[model samples]
Target: MKTLLIWCLPALAWAQAPAANPPGPWSGGLGVGNGLEAHATRQTGGHLLLLGRARYAWWGPKSGPGSKLFDQLNTRSRQTELAVLAGRSLPVGRCRAYAAAGLAYLLGRQLGDYRYTTRSSGLLWGDATYYYAYRRYQALGLPLEIGFQGPLGRNQQRLGLALQANFNPERSAYCVLLTLNLSSWGNRIK
Candidate 1:
């Protein structure tokens, strides 16, 4: 049994290897739609990449019996995250597809109790028309993503579409991103 296991280990490792090792450099991508997404991908070896990503989202309150400055449907709660991810890409037809998972530091910020105040003394506080608040937050998150990539022009430029699911101790959501790569800055072997 031990000899059989030893023989299988090498086979398993070989099965996971890429058909070809394509050395790559650090490439940056910017994404839009369903929030903002940005990443820098640098190839460590073969199809492996180190991805640094950043994202931001918003959840706003509606008009609710108050006359605060934000009551005009022009305000939002801010949520932002930053992460370092590792991914692997494989060639599929004319494109390359990848999957990545990472931990993110998230910050959810917004006003808690909001109100409008009049300078007129103490006995004139009213209920149905004011806004006041403090900031709220959720600190940690995990993000999982899958994406497809295609070349754009030259210089290792590419375009990508990514789908992501973000999980936090307090909140969770899904987002889709359309990404544009500017250039590969890390690998000089173009």
Candidate 2:
């Protein structure tokens, strides 16, 4: 009985140790929508994401602007973006959330031609030329999210969703994202 008690005490101590919770290494997804801006112009674009992305964040924000004309000239611009994310485990009822903020760069372009009159000659000129330009802006914002993860078929996988709100010196945008995760790939020893 004394020998059995000594063996069981070590096992109980190992089981009572708190599990470690660390940030995930890599995650990516594909999504298509036009809720980033509040303009009539619909934007179609995809982003490639890298997790633990704190090193290269010094590049700031990415932005662009443009003008379109159909009898009347219309101009538009975008200034900021936010990324909110989370992870969870249902068996343990555990969850975590994180937010990131940065700057955005803006690009501008003209899509149509408009007539201009020469101030000195008083002569009307009908010439069409496209214009392109870029501008840089700063932004600081955050996003919040929740998620869950567990074991599946000898492999560990996680699923999560997030809503992000980004704000910059000029404007703000919102994004909704769905994430899928597969982990424990390289830790197996056969």
Q: Best candidate per lDDT, number?
A: 1
Mark the regions of model 2 whose C-alpha exceeds 4 Å error after superposition: 1-136, 146-155, 185-190
Candidate 2 per-residue lDDT over residues 1-190, each given as its tens digit: 9999999987655433343332233333332233322111111122212222111111212222223322212223333333332323233444333333333343322222333322233348543432333344554544322323322212333444545444444444555544444433333321
Question: Cα lDDT of all candidates, in order?
Answer: 0.67, 0.33
For candidate 1, the per-residue lDDT at 107 reads: 80
Candidate 1 residues 1-190, lDDT tens each? 9999999987655433442433356678788877898888875544646478888876556444333444433245667878877778787875678888888888876645555643334567533334457467767778888888764344455667988777887667577888877554544554
Best candidate, TM-score-wise? 1
lDDT of 2 at 10: 75
